[model samples]
Target: MIRLEGITKSFAGKEGAVAALDGIDLTIARGEIFGIIGSSGAGKSTLVRLINLLERPDGGEVFVGGERVTDARGQRLRALRRSIGMVFQHFNLLSARTVAGNVAYPLELTGAYGRNEIAVRVAALLDRVGLSEHARKYPRQLSGGQKQRVGIARALACEPAVLLCDEATSALDPQTTGAVLDLLRQINRDLGVTVALITHEMDVIRRACDRVAVLDRGRVVEEGPVTRVFLHPRHAATLRLVREAEPDGGSLDAAAASDLGGRAVRLTFTGPAAHKPILGRIARENLVDYAILAGRVGHIRETPYAQFIVSLSGRDVAGAIAGLRASGVDVELQGVAPVPEIEERACHVV
Candidate 1:
């Protein structure tokens, strides 16, 4: 588990000191996949570094596994860092080392294991990451995904309790990205390792996170379960992210949907509701003619979900909206200005 309180970090800029993180408070529960999403300059990488004491905050406290590590020094700090593994956005592998050697490097650095022990550990890690066959391959000879697998194997060499994936899938193609994400999920489940994923891609969050925090301008604008945040994003930055991740091949933007005229509402269906005949049944029952502007049916980390924006005409439009809501569908009136609400996540849970 990780907890940060009033966390603030600033850096020297051309103009002056620039705040990279400001008054941030977050808690990541043990054994959960937590996500931090934002655009560039959201301080995502900087924040992750703070967890491992790679970047000390300008102010506030840093706690890892319930120990206050803000002021830890010498051996204490080194021990704490060893308990938290980190995966980089870029595959920061030693090109000079082969796959097995790369994984063995971290264990060798600890000076706690003998040569035989390190060799056994390295072999097990390579097998765990499905790279046993490529143990002798060099980084340059591997594909992007393979190289990342090597990085992951290296990170796991220490058997850290928490794995910090800072844009771990950002450099790969979509198909490769999905494979990496799936691998992370597998690691989380099989190893009981708490994963904190940092990325700009909403799809990554949707695919991998149990809960998420949306960052904008170095502050957390919203945080909650992925289902709630992805389905009914309450912040402008969060809304934009959901739109960008639309599986309907880019849903109509607010500006684009404005000219459609009829009363428009976005509907979100989840779980069994996603498979129900809610839309057609409600339309007929309420006698409302509907036009779907954009939508898609998909899964968010195995939870079936569907979302669509519909323009409603004919009578009883209100009745139709009510019907959809009564059927477990979340209906949001389109074009309505969003009220930014930061839902406090169960980050404090132990």
Candidate 2:
């Protein structure tokens, strides 16, 4: 329930004004977990802050639930902010305040609830985050995961409709990161809160977000459903991020060369058509040797897709490729590898 239209933010630099967000146009549907991903200096954090008016845009409009949020002053701004809760990577909790106290602080600021109501809300929120036992502990008394749970409880104290997470799990260990992500997913599902997370971790996006926008150098290079984007990333930056999570040596060109070696074709399969056992049937029917060089299995939108590199050795490599194409496989033959002669190593013919 948030939209940013042509939002641009620039700051004075030594040479000139440097744009942090360049004409960012994006929309977050109600009750959807949206992810914004980019490398360092890509303005991801800046863009998120603009959504809550923590950083005012230099140009364009910021709308929350279709209501304009820019240029708001005093009470208007404060009220708008209360509707949006933010969590950070650092787990910004006060060392002096106990977990319960920290959560109650936000409700106190709203000043619309009595002491008992605030106490009830705080206890419920703490229990929701699975930190009911740690209610009396200060920030220093808890672990990183516990501290983040406190931050999450504090964020939910106001019952915000939109939650902004800026690298929320970056500072935690992998196991704890997963735990936090699960909590976020539960928050979205149970509370129906619209979540917008800015993170560099694809695993986080894959596990949590329903849609994603890939930002590069203050501009969104790609945006779409999480599964679609993961399966067929159109941008180089997007591909880079995906590849980082599952590393494969060499570039795409190098991979093509090593796999094909000017011998066989490269095939691309997407959607439901990719699920067929094409390779198995081809190998079984053809009396030729097929050597698989490199391949990987990955999930996009929680669906399995495989990318493979293989070599075909026989007198009729072209025939095998043609047969595959005829069967509705996307095949591309690069060149040909020199046919190797089979020589008798020893006297097998006794």
Candidate 3:
């Protein structure tokens, strides 16, 4: 329910104007968890802030639910912002206020509800975020996850249609991150809140996002369904992020490459193909053998995917690759390894 059209933003720097975001065109569907990912300084944080007009764009339009809000000011801007909730990486809770008071602050600022109504709303929000038991506790009295829950509850006080998360789980431990992600998913499914989250962690995107946009140097390099982008990353920026996220499936080093005696290829299998013994069947049919240099079989969101880097030999390498392609497997020929006797190792032998 959010759209950015050719959005550009720049800032004053030592080197004159430095562009933080350049020509960003993005659409996040209603009730979907959309993720924006990039390394530090990639303008991901700036892009997220632009959605709520926290950072005004230098050029282009911002639309929410089909309304152009690029130049919204005064009450209009305030109203637009009220309809959008934001949660920060560091839980921005008021230390002086209790949990219930923190959540009630937004409702108080809106001046739309009476004291009784604000109290009811605060109680409901606290319950929704599973913080009812800590309603009277101050920020210092709560754990990191609990503080984040308070932030989430406060954000929802206005009953916003869209939720903007700026690395909301980055500070939490892995277990806490998973729990927070699960809560976000539930909020999307049950409350029908449209979520746009920006993070550097691919694991967060894989766990919580339906679609993702990859940013690099203020430009969007890749954007697609999480399954497609994660399984078969095409852009160099995307590939780098994927490798960092799945280090075990990284490319072979020079020493490892020297051991394999033929063509090196990477195969990506998805859907039903991922479940099949296609590699074995292709090898038996084409009279070829392969040594798996690196491989991983896992799910990207709900879709099962298998990726393998293998050294192919025993003549018929081209035929085997063609067979894999015909069977809907994506194959990338990495290059031919040096010709010699293949090393007998404990790697995946097929």
Best by TM-score: 1
Q: Tell me the tens digit of each residue's lDDT in model 2 across 1-350.
A: 99999999999999999999999999999999999999889899999999889899999999998898788889999888898999989988888899999999999988899999998999999999999998898899899999988998899888899999999999999899989988998999999999999999777887789999999999999999986676556787887777666533213333434444335444555556568888767766675456544444545544655555556766566777877778776665544432111111111110
Compose the digit string of candidate 1's lDDT tens values, residues 1-350: 89999999999999999999999999999999999999999899999999999999999999999989999889998898889988998899998999899999989899999999998998888888888999998999999999899988888889999999999999999999999899999999999999999999988998899999998988999999998998788888898777666444253445434455568787888999989888999999988887766666777899988777677877898999988888888998866542221111101100
Off by over 4 Å in 2: 247-278, 285-290, 298-301, 311-350
Please provide TM-scores, in order, for all candidate models, with all chains considered together. Answer: 0.92, 0.84, 0.90
lDDT of each: 0.85, 0.79, 0.86
Could you give the candidate ranking by lDDT, starting with the highest?
A: 3, 1, 2
Q: Which of candidates 1 and 2 is the stronger one according to TM-score?
A: 1
Candidate 3 overall lDDT versus native: 0.86
* lDDT score of residue 36 within candidate 2: 99
**Native-to-model Cα distance after best TM-score fit, residue 323 in candidate 3, in Å:** 3.3
Compared to the true structure, candidate 1 yields what TM-score?
0.92
| Candidate whose lDDT is highest | 3
Ranking by TM-score: 1, 3, 2
Candidate 1 off by > 4 Å: 246-261, 336-350
Judged by lDDT relative to the true structure, which candidate is superior, 1 or 2? 1
